[model samples]
Structure formats: structure tokens, C-alpha cells
Target: MGQDETVSNTALEPAVPQAEASRRRLTIEVVIVLGLSLGQSAVYSILRIIERMTRNVPLSQQTSTLNQSATPDRPWLDLTYQLVNIIFPLFAVLLVLYLLQLTHPRPWRMIGFDLRRPGFDAWFGLVIAAAIGVPGLGLYLGARALGFNTQVQAAALADNWWTVPVLILAAAENAILEEVIMIGYLYTRLRQLSWRWPMIILGSALIRGSYHLYQGFGGFVGNLIMGAVFGLVYLRWKRVAPLVVAHTLLDVVSFVGYTLVAPHVSWL
Candidate 1:
């Protein structure tokens, strides 16, 4: 019995160092990701926000330009640039996933990527999108009315077979990158660092809002509210897939709807 006990203790010992190494690897990966990829945006956003504040420029007068030509001088270059715009965020998502897999052998599953729950996620996403969409549109209009936000042009692409598809893909990429990296990876890493749930949520939400500062104070405020609500929803449901869907839905409406109606509607 003593010999058997000795054997069991010896067998268990290897796992201790293995677990410690795993943890160390994760910490390193987290640091690298924050500096290089998705997490880097918030830092830049914060600096820009400071600059905007200092400038005291009228946000109502300023145009928050997006979807500018990738290469105005050369159509070939522009096409390539356009493609790369969508690819960039997708690559960031992939990079962090690779980093996550270093420690989390099943990172996707850990972050609520459940293939089995597709129907549920879709239903939940539509519900959340509906909940967010009406108020979100109202928020934008109200902000613009109050001279707080710039009148945003959702789609600037010229007509082509690929234009709508490219816009749709861009929206999807935004959803994936923001939801996966911001909520899934950031929150999980923070939680592992022994942060409390509220702090983690707030931190994540603030970062989300921060990166949208280019849209002016209204953007900061609206997205800040969105961040908090989305963060809480992610915490409660633990399904990133739904958040992604909802986000995509929101952007699609914004981009496509704006393109179609901006010409006919004077207020927009």
C-alpha cells in the first residue's frame, strides 16, 4: 500500500510543472496580443480621443469619414486595398485564436463557440438585434439632430457586382473581430488575471467604446452604452456567436440601408 501511494504521488507530480508552464505561456500570449493586435486599437483610440478633446473641434461640423478609397489613383490598387480592409480584421481574429490555442486547447468551445447551438444562437441574436436596432437608429438620428454627431455615410463604394458583397463581408469581419477579440479573448484573459466580473465587463465595454471615438462624442456615448449592454449580455449568455450575428445584422442595416436611402432622404 505504501509503494502504491508512492507511485500515485510520483505520477501526479509531472502535471504541476506542466500546468505552471501552460499558465506562463498564456500570460505571455495575452501580453503579446494586447500590444500587437485587437487590444492595441483602444490605446490608439484613447490618444485620439484626447487629441479630439484638446482640439475642441465642432464634431457636428466634422465628417467622420469611413470607407474612403483604398487607392484613389489606381483601380487595381484600390481593389486590392478594398479586399485587404476586410481581410485585416479577419487576420487579427485568426492571430488571436492561434495565440489562445497555445494554452486553451479548445479555445473556441471555451468562448461559447457551440456549433450544436446554431439555431438558438441565431434566434437569440435576432432578438438582441431587434432590441438594439430601433434604439440604435433613434440614438443616431437624435444625436445628429442635436448637432452632436456627424451625418455618417454608411457606404461610399461605387456600383459594382462586388460592392454589396464586399460591404456585407466587411460588416461580418467587424462583427467577428470585435466580438471574438474584444469580448471573448479580452474578457477571458482578464478573468484569468483574477479580475472581478464587473471590472472585466466595464473594462471590455470601455475599450469597445473607445475604439469608436472617431465618430464623435455621440459615437463615444452611444457605443459606450452599447458596450455595457453587450458586455452584460455576453456575460449572462456566454454565447459569442449570437453577439456576432447581432452585430452583423446591425451593420448590414446601417451600410446597405444608408446607401439605398441616403439619396432620397434629406434628413439623413
Candidate 2:
């Protein structure tokens, strides 16, 4: 009987190690997702506070001489804040994954970040973009027809050729941050909870739209539609890179068009 019991224990030893490794990988993924999200939220809150405090100061002497002072270093400050906001969250995610050794070549390949395979899906992805893009274009026009605020305020910024690069970077950052959190992390976590596809997509869309609520009703509706479309695309493709590229294209068009064209449109 003792000999049989020892045999059983020996049989389970390999299984135990495999189970332990699986658990560790899962734990690392969970921690990295949660930590990066929480860190980004905290940083956004701090930025809001700083913005409110700075808004208290007058911009011109006519408003209030005592409060009026030029922020001579404003450009640098804005750039720094943008960099911190954009880069820190990505760094947090990468750092945690690195520490846990879960960022091996296999994991990245599994995540579909491996770009080596150029297949039919790449063409299909472009087709999907066009299908979605046409309707999105119509919707924006409809919004404008309904007397929405399509006027862009940052026009002068684009006068310089350098602004094009800056805008591209901003769009890329937006795509990465949003896609990583919403599709990559949140969808994976929700799946673990046995969530239905519709529920996951709707929840993601709502959350995505909610984040843009501060931009006003038009922005909210636009973002909500954008979120729904992106969510559908994600569901279909399961590859984030396509969605990121599509998103960047959409944003670049919107920003550049609004800045350059909307204000000059007679109907607007």
C-alpha cells in the first residue's frame, strides 16, 4: 500500500508544476492589466487637478492684472504632460509583463502582435475598414447637418509642417492606449468571467464613449458610434493592429479636417 501511494505522488509531480506555471502566468497578466489601468486613471485625475488650478489664472492683463501672467514655458509643459500621460501607462504594462517573464516570444505571437504573416486577412481588414468608414463618414455629415459643432479650435497649430508629425503621434498614442485597455485587457478579463460577446462589446462601447463625455454631446455620440464600430471590428478580426491603424486614420482625418475645413464651411 505504501509503495502504491508513493507511485501516485510521483505521477502528480509533473502536473503540479504545469498547474503552478499556468497560475503564475495568469496572475501576472491580471496584475499588469489592473496596475496599468489604475496608474493611468490616477495620473488623469492628477492632470485634471492641475488643469483646474491653472485655469484659475487669467490669461491677459485685462482680465485680472494680479492673476495675469504668461506661462512662458507652456509649450514644454504641455509636451511633458502629454508624454507622461501617454508613455507611463504603456511602460507600466510592459514592466510588469517583463518582470513576470510572460513576455516571451510565444506570448507575443499568441497575442497576434507578430507581423510576419501577410495573409488574406490583411486585405479583408482593409475591406472591413472601408465598409465601416463609409457609414462613419455619413454619420459625421449627418451630425454636421444637424448643426453640430464641427468647428476646430486648433487650426493655427497645423499651419506649421511640424504639427503633422505631432498629430500623427497623438493619434497613434490614442489608438494604442485605447485598444490595449479596451480590447486586449478588458475583453480577455470579461471572457474569463464567462461574459457573452454582446455584453462584452456593449460594455466596452459604453466605457469607451463615457471617457469622451467631457468633450460634449456631439463628441459623446461620435465616440460612441466610433466605439461600437471598433468593437465590432475587434470582434470580427481579433487582431488589434488593424483596429489601431483604422482608428489612427479616422482620428487623423477628423482632426486635420476639422482644423482646416470645418471653420471655412459656409453651412457649418
Q: What's each prediction's TM-score?
A: 0.84, 0.61
Which ten residues in a row are the worst by lDDT in model 2? 60-69
Which lDDT tens digits does candidate 1 get at residues 43-71?
A: 78777656655666666665665666665
Candidate 2: regions farther than 4 A off:
1-86, 92-105, 118-126, 140-159, 266-268
lDDT of 2 by residue, 218-258 (tens): 44466677777777776776766676666767666655655
For model 1, give the RMSD to the true fold: 6.6
What would you estimate as the lDDT of candidate 2? Answer: 0.55
Report the C-alpha displacement of residue 139, candidate 2, in angstroms. Answer: 3.1
User: lDDT (0-100) at residue 110 of candidate 2?
Assistant: 41
